[model samples]
Target chain A: MEFEMKIDYYSGDPGEFIKVIEEKCTGCGQCAKFCTRDVWEADGKIYRPINLKDCVECGACWNICTADAIIFGDPKGGTGVRFTHG
Target chain B: MTEDNFFDVIVVGAGCAGPAAAKKTAELGLKTLLIEKSPEPGTKTISGTCINLAGMHNEDLYYILKGPIEREIHSMRTYHINDARTTVFNEIPTKGVLLLSIRRDIFDAWHTEQAKLAGAEVKLSTTVTDIIEENDYVCGVITDSGEEFRCKVLIDAAGVNSIVGRNAGLIPKRSGDNMILYVTVAVELGEEVINDRFSDEQGGYCIEYYLAPGIQYKTWPWIFPKKDTVTLGTGGYMTKDLFNDKITNVNQYMQNFLNLPIVKRKLEGGKIVSWGLHLEYDEKISQKVKNGLILTGEAGGFVIPFLGEGMSPAFATGIFAAKTAAEAIQKNNFSKESMSSMYEDMIEEDLFLQGFMHVGKINKESILKKSEEEISNMMQSVVLGGGFITNAVHTKWLEGAENGDIEKVQEALDFLEFIQPYRQIGSEFEEIYRKLRAEGGS
Candidate 1:
């Protein structure tokens, strides 16, 4: 059987991240709508990331949090690409 | 005596975007000149409220904004009228916070000073008559005062109705109809008192409310709390019918809604201050730089959809254009390739271009196919009103809720489709809801 590649990096799943405080959620869905990650779904009233590995730690969810439920940890240094031309 | 005219770059419009670009260029050791049509920056510029950070293309200038911001909004409350309910939202993307209402005039003055400190020469009250062209390349800009400033690159941050962009032949004479947005009124109010009275979740700050609705057209009122004063205004989609007296003149249309019980309650002894119009344009993205000319800010049609807020994008564009111009001078190359790198930089930022495209698609479709009422219904149903349903259904009881009816599912899916394009940045919307429910904020 082909092996599934594991992303060893410590990127938190926005889905599980939101689930930590799922019951307290009023389901305004603002987080889901504004998230650059496509992490939350309003229809299901749930937060699940399609791929937790892709999060760049932009901290958008943390800023948008009125409830302050989302948490973020530091990523490994020199892990991402910086657009010098940008 | 004629000055040496040693400027390497001349930027028009000292608004937030213009001055920011000038400051960046100056900081990079480029001889920069910033020009403004008004007595100062943001004097003539008009926008409803503070800028959003999701569209920020330059991170350096984003940090600079921290010093001038009036307040940061971590959450928003959207009222659903038909349902007579309100949905409170906590999650806003981390890109940046909603502006603490600020006086564009004051903020712009500070920005101009920053640019000056960075070594840019700023000439206020200077209006552009035309752009000087050598062959197809824009060489300099001519002011109405019979003066000409020569530079290798001409950056246009001239606000939404940009005469420089049109004159430079960078943008077309006629552009497509995204939405006919016409805003009138710039009423000023006492900031502290207004914020104390009106601001709810984010201090005395900016608040937007829906007054009336339709699919393609809608109108809303805003109370933006600034440093010394507040900007209270209203606007809607521009169509022939909105101006017709049979329905309502623009002024009456606004007054009728503002006088409502809920809205009027907030303005119980308030005064009607100054008023102005914000004529907006929605255009397809094109190469903002051609030859030696570049376009920045709203003049480049960088405003956001759903809310039409663009100050941050404008500022970001300014920074990009100035840096690009500086790079060209450093390399001694001002070709289309050299100058257009800034435009490429902005486009490459997924948020900037993707946001632009998302709003573009929604607006084009809304104006072309949907009626004003339909657009309103969609906004009310999916965004404003729907938010309430989402929050309430998840937290409390829906009274007569059913599991999974195909028809209900289809209707819900259709509603989601209506708001798919305008959904916020990373889809953190649902996360906010989940967190709220888990925390039991009832």
Candidate 2:
């Protein structure tokens, strides 16, 4: 059975906030596992930030990556997810 | 810019710790700059949406922002998934502890305002790209906009990412075992629904915790009631093996948590207002300060190991860092020797020593020694008595005295006596000690 994935609840474009250095990525897939958003996807090899727009810039991917392959910064002003009731 | 762009203190990340440090440093007459990568404080930050504000009651920041506190959590309910048993721990006034459920966005915004009023220059949307070093001492930071701002002392309150501290080589990298990967969802259900469903009266909001052993190892799920929403979350150690077996993805874990009968029933019609992923490190405080740099809050590994509470520690360490930085600035000594002593002494006196008492180290061997019921009872007791160490002392002291094991009684008594002055469980411990002594068997 094929089903469509639900849209992420968070709004705004993450806009280049998370950068994955492919050379350093070991295809360990830890980033994809740690991230709640489907931002990173593993394709049998290296993990890529396939859904950067859905990224909330939580920095969990960068922190869990042992190879230091990910660089995460906050999105530009007024461009990332804004919580109304945090 | 050149050296003229320097301040006495530069605090990176305007989360819980940064603003507090900036406020204190500026109040002490030091030129201070507080920078935030987000457009506003708390916009990108993730908490369980419930903060225990017991310790911050007397602070000016808490006093100013106390209006936003949604409810005072008077009791907590724990559900043992394996046995389907529940235990409740009610708050005792004499214990001097109660959790205040708060909205972090409102709280962080209020804190930032307080810092600005105290004369700290708060720059929003300013990302610190890297630490600027001079002669092996971190003297300043370079922002993403290619602007360099030098300072006599740099404080990193940048949270679990610990960007400035990590880049400066002051904070060590943490492994997956030491990291906790968690997700939270804020479900909106209006005030009446919340009050009706959670039975919210004055000081009567309940924070429920679920221990699902079959689903995940060393993991727990929580349902915390807020003013108009309920926060559902779960956390587990970030190990590859654990991830491979159960939590292949955090979203899958969240889905599983929601599927639980209790959670589904309570949140049947509630809409998810917001969701987020946050990482917490459980490492003890180590190498937090060096020549011209200091690490505070989660960046300094201040989150409590067992319960995953960081806000209180973040606030406490932020204030301590500010005081320490002020002292160093007043003495005009940014050297490693002077600043390290000032920072270390405050941390040791206020945070580190007390933290050591409640390490809450859990292992497979310890779990194996107890029956499932015993483990459940111990978990309830630990949550009720503040932490594992206090609960252990209380249990051992009572059991040993009852069994007339002289050596065990003596050891438990001695440990209780040592930790009494520092711990808040003093009155409770004293009552037990007096009863045991009056029995006079041992």
Candidate 3:
């Protein structure tokens, strides 16, 4: 049997949320690995966001990246994971 | 920014610790400013099942959170996958000391409001980018918006990220091995379903700790019930390879935990509501206080290692840091000598240090070597002794003495014997023994 998992992802206006500096990215893939939201994907050579819309802006990718490649800021107001029962 | 931007004390990161520190500082009539990187307090906070409020008093910062206490935990059960059996430890005499369970987001937001009511100026969505130093003393901070805020003293309460502490050279960076990764999902199951499954009628909760083989970490998985939701999570020590393998793919671990028969049975119809990851410092590191600065909460590695609880320690240390900051301002002495004595010396005497010492003694390998009965006995004693000491005696200790490993039983007996004197000294240790005896143990 499979358990159903639902995640609400929020993004702000263009150029407002997470940004990966390609030059600084050394293909470490730490951002792709550490994020639980599956926001980043690895292409075997480097890492890129496959679902940037899924980013909750938790900043885990920004903090875990050693090469200082990812930039993460809070999304615009009322744009992130909304906890209904928390 | 002008000279008017200066304050008597500036606190960074308005989580559990920062707001508490700011509240205390402001209540003391200091010009205090609390800054948070998240859009609001609790926005970035993630916690496990429930917080153990053993050491907290009525005057604590936790009480200020004002979140509805979901349950008062009176018992805890540990499940061993090898035997598929459970050991139950119930507090005696109706209900003994209890723990409070509340949602982290709600609790934190309420705490931030408490800080505001205490007269601290709070700035949301403000990130402290760097620590401004002069002659090796951190006297100010530079925010992300190119604004500088100077202060006589800075409190670093930035949780496990340790942003200000690491940047200012006050604390070391946590490595993977020393960090524990927690991937949690809060599932809404409705209060009726939760009450039926846990057999809790008075809003009491149960904590189930799972120990499965092949897991590198000593403490593996846990299922905790809140008011209307259940928090399911798995935590393990982060090894370099594990970081590259399992730690990176935490959802797989969560999936495995959910697939367990014990978990699957209880959460059969729950709907996942939220998902998040939190990093905690599981090992102790030194140098939490420097000239003109103090570190509280996870930034200071204040979380207990074995249980992985940080709320009480964070709140306690927050208040302690604020008190020390107030003294430094009153005496007009921000030197490392004075600040270290005021903060570090006091923290060394706190319960977090004592708990850290106790957890450090029980090596994971040694625990893994013990028989099931021995492990159960030790865990029972741990809970009864408030997880800080191992002096409580149980009938299982006597049974193990006859049927189990002689050396292990002798070790447990030796520790109990060592504290026998304190049991008669009419102190707190005596109270613990009295409770143990009342619980039909000893």
Candidate 4:
């Protein structure tokens, strides 16, 4: 199966769980570079979590964001990506 | 906040560490609360899916072994694939199980259940959005439900990207060398198929580790077998070089790993059942405590992902944090100096956690200093001297002797001396496990 198809998420909006601190983003695109899900997208001079629903809540974009622009927070309770036991 | 919202100890994130911490605190008669974001305690988390028994030798942690488990692992198969040939080392270290294969979902849920059974109040489907601080002390937390829960001591086991740790200004922006981003995929192959492919006559299963260029960047990729699912993960330290021409992303590396002849054959009929992305913080944080708050597990930087050993440290630190919290409550002092020092002392006193961490430090340092190709060549020769630790110590001591660097030799000797007692601890733990098993355990 495709990597995308194997994942699951609760049915609901997760709110703005990930956002780019516009002023802080250097646009080096490290967040986008590091993110495997392509959740971040370039927007003029900053990056936004354009595809938040695709996020697995891994926080890679947040961790590798050199400019400290990603405010990665948990989704609403019981409403985010759900992973089966590994 | 109402009096009902107050707890003696509140543990956030019911993962590996939270449940342990809460269980310990509640067992000590402290009013405890364990909170998790997911409706199901462990359904949202992903990991390598195996626990090292050698790490859980502590008498306090023996009960953890009674949780839901999948398989007993006694053997390991390491593949060192070079341009010339592939060297396979199938090591049956002992008759006793060295590790236990687990489903993080079931295992963590079981663990949290144990905590609940031990009298810790649990709140599922709650996310701690912010913490309530009083007089520079994190004495309470605010959940997503807009309800506030206060506690004398708060335990943070919220994992690598924990907002609690970040909001406290302890978790820094970590990338590059110290951060590892690994992707894992579990394939379903029926229980019979898995048993036929991955089990042996010794009533034990094997974990396969692959090492080669393109497969992973320095770190070893692992295949761990569950009851009916086989989990395979491969990735590297989140660095500039993580992606190259050959591997554009982690999935590409996963593709290459799945393409390997041996792995491909084993996974022939298997279909990918679940996939996950995980990040591990390899380095310890500068501080895990301040005032009324304490950090445990990945939030506290207690994970050594490259070594594939974390669950034990999580349990150890969790229990230690609980003990420290209980002691602080006893003394009526939640000062950083008192609680922090006590927490550090407890962790430092645990020979198993300390020794495991020391070996990881030595091995990681050794591996990073050498290239992948060089390490593969060495493993072909090095496994005979034991594993990475032995290879590193031997090489360092010999090189020191050759270069007349007495300090270097002395350093290696000191490490060896410190690690000596830990080396023979497997049998001791195995004996303890046998006794525990006979005394009635899962």
Candidate 5:
């Protein structure tokens, strides 16, 4: 079976739950390097959680970012990824 | 915080620990409140999907056995794959259930409902965005809606990436050695297909563990069957080497796992249903409590993810935390010293928790120390003579002898002796389970 990285999400806006502290990012790209969901994207000098809507809230990018650039917080309640068969 | 929002005890994150903590606290006559970020409990959670039976031996936990069980598992299979050949060790079926399979979404929802029935007011889809700490004492919490709920003591069952624990300064951003990041996918195989493929004869399903080089790093990949889907997962420690040239990301590991010939055949007509991602803290946190606050479950780091153990320990520790909260409330002392003594003292005495923790530590350490070829050879020895337990002890003993470390050998001996009774606990637990089922609540 080819899952093709398909995941389900709730049908509402989660708001700007994750953001990049541009000054502290340092362009290391560790967040993008380890992110399984492709939530982070490289934007010249910093990595941004561009696809924050698709985030499963696993905290890998935040946990791996050595520079503490990824300002991670919760999306609005009940408005993020909705996992099935977990 | 308003008077209406004040509660005797407040529990956050309605996952495995939160509901148990809330239910027990409410049953103890404390006005308890449960806050969950997800619209539904467990819908945002993920795991290898087996609840170890050792946890249910406590009468306080037997009610869990009566929950919505997908399958009662009695046997385990470990696939030791390498370049040479595949060595599959199938444990002989036991008379009693060794574990139970479950769907987290269903189980957690039911558990939360139980907490509600026990008089705990639950708030679904509410995130605890900020913790209210007054002079180093956790007095209350602020939700996403900016609603503040005050409490005498707060139980943080908010999981590994807990906002409450992180804001409280107890859980530091950790990676590499102590943290584990894993990815899992569920395949829709239908209940008949799962039973047919996994061999659920005699009302017992089986769980599989895979140990291969490209599939995992310092951890075991697993396959567990639910009612209409099979859960397959693989990943490893968050080390610098985890994202190497061979395995660029966790998905590659999952792909490699699926590509394994044995795995490929088993999942042959299955359709991918859902995918999951999660992080787990392996080591126990140093500071699990502050004045007026307590951390249980993953927040306290009482989880061994590879063993499918987080839920059980979560339940165990959550109950203990509730008990500690009751004790602290009775004495009107919300200091860390008081809570820690009441909580950690019980944790220290839990033989099952301590034993599994030791086994998980030594097993992961010893397995990771060797090359894949060496592991296949070692596991072959496990089959030829003594079983899995003896093999672990035997490997440690050999290492100790090679290094001329008598203390290591002595420690190995002590571990063997310590784990001796646990090996035969199935029959004893069957008796206990039958007794408990007959009496009540099961």
Candidate 6:
């Protein structure tokens, strides 16, 4: 079964927006492709932050990051994907 | 004959297009029936990477999509085989135009609920087995469990595997080469780990790539960032023989991708948990409406051939079909002539279809004939020429580049014309092209 969840990037402290579990992160790099921030860079098949402070808190990297390595903070105030019309 | 339980219109398939049509039809006060073959709405749905908000109608769309969409895409990045280079852009036809990355299951369910709210009856976990016709005009439909439903209008939003269109004698069988198959792995990562990893970009958006060893069959892989999960997948063209064969072992290919310089560098510690398939269109849509029935989404072959994107078109067509069907019902007309106009209007209005039709013909030649060096040069032209559609439109100019008489400045203007409605998106195309060129050079 697929395990799906959502997180608010704009929620909580910007500094603490990212949460990494070393054991959970297998460094597969799938998250890197979805991240626009250039956060994760491979260091011998293990992904770590090049710099952690520049994140936009979009939560894309966290959602797509497998191995359950990435976690986010409290829910944000508003809803997501504000559409003009489908 | 038994008492007729007639609805103004009947929509088959509760995926993107069906729901769009249903919402509109119900809102218009047309008695509407939305049938879904899946156990729940969107249970069988699989959309491509990103959905472009190019044709959204604003008010109605906002109502339906506000809850299910995971995130909005503000920008994009494109990469080449070269590790040292990349392309990025932030321009489009409209600044306000933004696409949402959504889980198909959640989104479809939400759409079904919206249609129901508007007074459309939704039938889920049900299958439509046949279309009943008389004098070449569709009159009703039959289900596998021996139930019959009659309606004045019928819509086939059954996707690429659409049986209604084929059964109605609306379209011919498709070959394998026209098919596309995709496998996706949904992965999850920590918020802190992600923030620390990709802090350089603006919004948390998505990325795409035409990696090396690329050929006509090797389409790009996509990375879509949603609420708390990322959707990643790759697809390619196939021949009948290979298309019918079962996938050997995707794990091996995934592993190979994991070892790539870029993949290894970026996702060193990422993990994969779930996998799914996305079926590609097996034919180009030549016609979408018949005397009594109409097709939508992949069932109508609206996929973006070059990029393989279809969600936006699917959604737009959904709304368009609903309006058309509503008009037809009010006029007491369900003729093929009348419905075909709807198909034409939508295809004409869609940017994705315009761009795809204008350039889709050359995909095989461009993808299959060129070597790596030639491909790199071609991509450079796209970057320098302007935006994605502009770059693609100017491809003919590149063909003329061999003669050397074309004015360099004029090529940009000509490129703009080809993009038409998408002229504003030129810079985005240019940026991505530039990045790919830089990567190739490095």
What CA RMSD would you report for each candidate? 21.7, 7.6, 6.9, 1.7, 2.2, 15.3
Candidate 2 ranges with C-alpha deviation above 4 Å: A1-15, A42-45, A73-78, B2-4, B57-67, B83-97, B200-203, B213-216, B244-246, B351-377, B381-387, B392-415, B422-442
lDDT of 3 by residue, A5-53 (tens): 4554334342346777877888987777667778888766678877877
Off by over 4 Å in 1: A1-86, B1-3, B56-58, B82-97, B173-176, B179-181, B186-192, B201-206, B213-216, B227-229, B350-353, B356-360, B363-377, B384-442
Point out where model 5 deviates above 4 Å.
B200-203, B379-392, B395-400, B417-424, B432-442
What is candidate 2's lDDT per residue for B364-395, written digit by digit as tens?
A: 22433565456666676677676656665666
lDDT digits (tens) for residues B1-442 of candidate 6: 3544577788988888898888889999988888876655654544544556553433444444454566656555555565456444323324332556677777777778888998999887566767889888888778755678888888888777555876776645443456555545666554454444433355344444445442223456656666555666665544322222343333334444445666555554555544554456645667788897888887888776465567767777787788788888888899989877866776676665565555655544575566555665566555556645655445556666766756744654554566566645444543443344355421
Score each candidate by Cα lDDT. Answer: 0.55, 0.70, 0.68, 0.86, 0.85, 0.60
Docking class of 5: medium
DockQ, 0 to 1 scale, candidate 6: 0.02
True contacts kept of each: 0.00, 0.39, 0.15, 0.64, 0.68, 0.00
Better of 3 and 5 by lDDT: 5
Candidate 3 chain A: 10-residue stretch with minimal lDDT: A77-86
Please tell me what DockQ candidate 5 reaches. Answer: 0.75
- Write one digit per residue (lDDT tens) for candidate 1, span B248-356: 4344545654555565665555554444444455555476778888888777877664455666667777777877887788778788877786567655554554545
Ranking by DockQ: 5, 4, 2, 3, 6, 1
Candidate with top TM-score is: 4
Q: Between prediction 1 and prediction 5, which has the larger TM-score?
A: 5
Query: Per-residue alpha-carbon lDDT of model 3 for B307-420, expressed as tens digits?
Result: 556777888889999999999998999988898888877776654345444444454434445654566566656666655344323432554677866766776576566545
Better of 2 and 6 by DockQ: 2
Name the candidate that leads on lDDT: 4
- Write the residue-wise lDDT of candidate 5 on B31-93 in tens digits: 999999999999888873888887766778878777787876778788888788777887755
How does chain A of candidate 4 score by TM-score against the true chain A?
0.89
As for DockQ, the candidate ahead, 3 or 6, is 3
**Model 3, which residues run further than 4 Å from truth?**
A1-35, A39-86, B57-67, B83-94, B200-203, B213-217, B240-248, B360-388, B391-442
lDDT of 2 by residue, A1-86 (tens): 01112223334444587888888999998788667777899855788998888776667787778899987766654456665556
User: TM-scores, in order shown?
Assistant: 0.66, 0.83, 0.78, 0.96, 0.95, 0.70
Q: What clash count goes with each model?
A: 55, 0, 0, 0, 0, 54
What C-alpha RMSD does candidate 4 show over the true interface residues after superposing them? 1.8
